[model samples]
Target: MTTTDRRPMYWEEFSPDSARAGAELACLRRGVGREPGNVPEMWRFHRVRISDHEARTGAPSASLTAEHAALTLFAVHQQSQRKSMHRQGMGLGASLRLLRQSEKYKKNPQALNARVNALATSADVPELAYHLRGLITQLRGIGQPLDYTSLFYDVLAWHSPEGQERTRRRWGAQYYDWAESKAKQPQTD
Candidate 1:
């Protein structure tokens, strides 16, 4: 899963120096081969866009290839992570908006705080308010309200199947942490 350490699997195994370019017909296959379902929505969308472009105008020019798009996609991921890491919670109105969206908001204005406190306790995340803020940001990042019918607490982190697991991969090997080591260490309970 440490694709950040290896060459993008889409172009690995075959040596570019030895491989001959295909003319008249080109087959472009790409995947987040690091881990199954680890591929992000942004990458999937980028794939589709590339597919559409190829279908309409054939393969991209040699100067601008899928590798460039892949780099752009990875850069987008990195930029998003950077922004998420430093982002703070919503202000008063936004916080109130979140509270109103809560299922129990009509019952109590403090309901959101209580729910966040409970979530923070179970998640072992310090700072109830701050945790709630980050959780909300994560929730928004995952998708639209119509995508899932669950309440906020119902979804802890809604990354892709393997991307979600990637987040739990531990501090030393975190994908978002550029400084994290990519060495395959033994897992301990």
Candidate 2:
């Protein structure tokens, strides 16, 4: 089926109750830092989907690139974890925000902030992926989860200038808006 006809099966769909979920995640993990189509092992998991997507478009698939990046990052983030890392509605910005708020980083946030700034300032996919690997590692250290599906779409959008601006704006809002909303909440005795 084409990408438009069916959404790619992400980690969230695999129930944690089954071993298949862990096995699939393990397959994806092997692709970390490797170029798409280079890892023959991961091809079974992602190749057919990408081929279907490309077939429909009749051109190189941007979504496939984004999918590879997001999948690899998810594998990293989910490493050694019992629960699924793909939390719905948890975007990259929100995940980073949680990392920023973690007690470990609360005392000294400069390094965390610097990493985030680097990610924000990345000019292209390769640069973004490089920066993301570091941040994703940090998030894993803190046991934070993110929505890989949302991240896939965001990364795809990042391919175009207009989409990149919009994605950046949305991420900024997600990152900074959380504090404002929390501050506005009514205090109770």
Candidate 3:
């Protein structure tokens, strides 16, 4: 087995912060979601968050919540795919790295997944907040949208087995289904 095979699963304890993170991510996929106030509430907070993100920019740990890092990475991945498709076009966004940027964003999930897996082995939930904060701050320093949360579900589900199972129930990805199936399959070890 390789590193992934040997690595401990991310959701070993499944705390409330993690669950809130998962639920928040889940709600986004459905609508305004039950958390952060429905549509208007979500948009209000999202807008404020955007402004805060811009102001904080390179140093975003101050603004990060329990769900922030996963949310950011999740948002980045969706945006990257859209960018790859030539869908979103902003001033500088249209001018540079559209395709290349998309490729970079596309690869982020696995990179993030690996990082989270490593962190999971050593860090607990609260420490994860600081760890994720550092991760986001560093990414933001390079001018990435490390604060975006447009695709929160991906980050939630990517890191949590519970979120993945819920996502599979809601959206139905064969990969998640396969991963969930591992619970039933006899272990090789």
Candidate 4:
């Protein structure tokens, strides 16, 4: 049975069978055409906002389009990432806010991160963080949050059934980090 304060399952934790199971699960998740169906409708609707606005108001004729938005979002995301790679955690809050803005894109934060992790396996963790940071930055510039509640760490734990394992791993690390920091604090007695 799993304990309440169980640790994250890293490469070190998997048994032979469990490792195979994990690989199988990863394959299933990565299979062609496997899209997350429960992604919020608001995200879908947000994509249409630019086109919808263009149609109704005839603005940004030369400056805005879906592609523009996507690029701008990417650029902002990249900028934020540069900041993060320097060991700055303060930008996390702002970066998350940006992601919330770009929620309209086909992929949400979790999906995007998973994709990046899969495709960019050789990339350093700091590099990945930079990418995510850029995404958040772009989203925020356009007036959106990185969507903490909908895309938060805690939400991951309870939301997707498949995500639970990964979420657990991530949360375990986060909790451990927090606990370690707390443990190092001096008592004021």
Candidate 5:
């Protein structure tokens, strides 16, 4: 197989109806809050991908760490949902913006805004994960799904200062731009 063929498929690219993807997600769900090596069940699904990434890059498997964090967050966001939580084209900022607009939170937007601010300013992955858990719970309550594939890559990029700035800018733009666009639309009424 060519190198491209060996690369792991992003979750968003996977067909929502694929049984193989469903099974893989279920396995990842079982790994919520667990460390990478501790989840022996996930090894089969993620190990080869992690190894392949390390081999190709000649770097340590930080991909393993990022994937673990993203998958665990996906599990939390997906719990008890009949539909897949890995929605294509939905990024974290967009999903959070929806959550901010939900009736449950519309009355008290500051609470959600504070959470988003905390998440954006997190100093490290562990801190980010901690803040993300709360937001993911809120997302789950509102049935807001995001693209786990984007999130995984975002987390991987978080390891670098430049990536953090770029990611934050993208998210901020998505979040605030939605509100601006909505305001600019002419109301039918």
Candidate 6:
């Protein structure tokens, strides 16, 4: 039983502004300034958000939206590329450590997680989902089973499926199966 074992099982609540600030802070801690937009993934999220907002409010600011969209695309693309570089055999602790070593992740790792989780819930839901799936796949390849739903609930404050119930179902099923198997086995001397 370590400190992690004693931490809260889950956290609930989502605040968009908090998430945005956390993200900026995370980057600053990593020694990186506000990243410029230039990648497809980041751009997609920005585009989705801008479009959604514009549709809702009938605001017409194509130039501003385009600029922000470009910046976001670059950021997400860079992150994905970075994740691929370190994916093999890296655990959460290792990843966190690596991130912290950089100027961008010096602050609370949990907070960074929340920021990333929030980014994933940005307007382009499908793109975020695909990118996350790839990241999770890479983590899994390294023998890590990322509990993303739990992570999102604990860290991010974005409008998206929290996946809490799904996580519970998976955990319960796995735990029960393990328990049943253990009960059926003869005791080892």
Candidate with best lDDT: 2
Q: Provide the lDDT at 134 for model 6.
A: 43
**What residue runs in model 6 are displaced by over 4 Å at the alpha carbon?**
1-122, 152-156, 160-189
Q: Which pairs of residues collide in candidate 3?
A: none
RMSD of each: 17.6, 3.9, 17.1, 18.5, 4.8, 15.9
TM-score to true structure, per model:
0.20, 0.82, 0.26, 0.21, 0.77, 0.22
lDDT of 2 by residue, 1-189 (tens): 344665555665655667676777788888877776567667665632556656676554677678788878887887777777788899889988888889978888787878888888889887888899999888888888888878887888889999888888888888766446656989888
- After superposing candidate 5 on the true structure, give the runs of residues whose Cα lies further than 4 Å from its correct spot: 1-30, 51-60, 178-189
The alpha-carbon deviation from the true structure for residue 117 of candidate 1, after best TM-score superposition, in angstroms, is 0.9
Ranking by lDDT: 2, 5, 6, 3, 4, 1
lDDT of 5 by residue, 2-94 (tens): 225545534545454665766766877777766665677676655225566566765546567777888778767766666778886898999
lDDT of 1: 0.30
The pairs that clash in candidate 5 are: none
The lDDT for every candidate, in the order shown, is 0.30, 0.78, 0.34, 0.34, 0.75, 0.35
User: Which tens-of-lDDT digit does each residue in 1-189 have in candidate 6?
Assistant: 122533321111212235353453234223212232322333322322235766576563433332332222223323322232222233233443344344554565565455445434445433444344344333433333333223333222222255433433443344223335666889999
Models sorted by TM-score, best on top? 2, 5, 3, 6, 4, 1
Q: Quickly count the clashes in candidate 1.
A: 0
lDDT of 2 at 73: 87
By TM-score, the better pick of 4 and 5 is: 5
Regions more than 4 Å wrong, model 2: 1-4, 20-23, 47-60, 178-189
Residues 1-189 of candidate 3 have per-residue lDDT tens digits of 122432222222223334254444343333311222223313322322324554555443322232344433333323212122112212111212232234544555465445444434433333443444444443433444322222233233444566544533432232123334667888897
Please write out the lDDT profile of model 1 over residues 10-115, one tens digit for every residue. 2222222333322100222122222212234323322112346555765543212323333222222222231221112222223334444555454664655554
Query: What residue runs in model 3 are displaced by over 4 Å at the alpha carbon?
Result: 1-117, 120-127, 158-160, 164-189
Strongest candidate by TM-score: 2
lDDT of 4 by residue, 73-129 (tens): 322432322121111232233333234335454356565455334423323322333
Better candidate by TM-score, 3 or 6:
3
Candidate 5 residue-wise lDDT at 171: 86
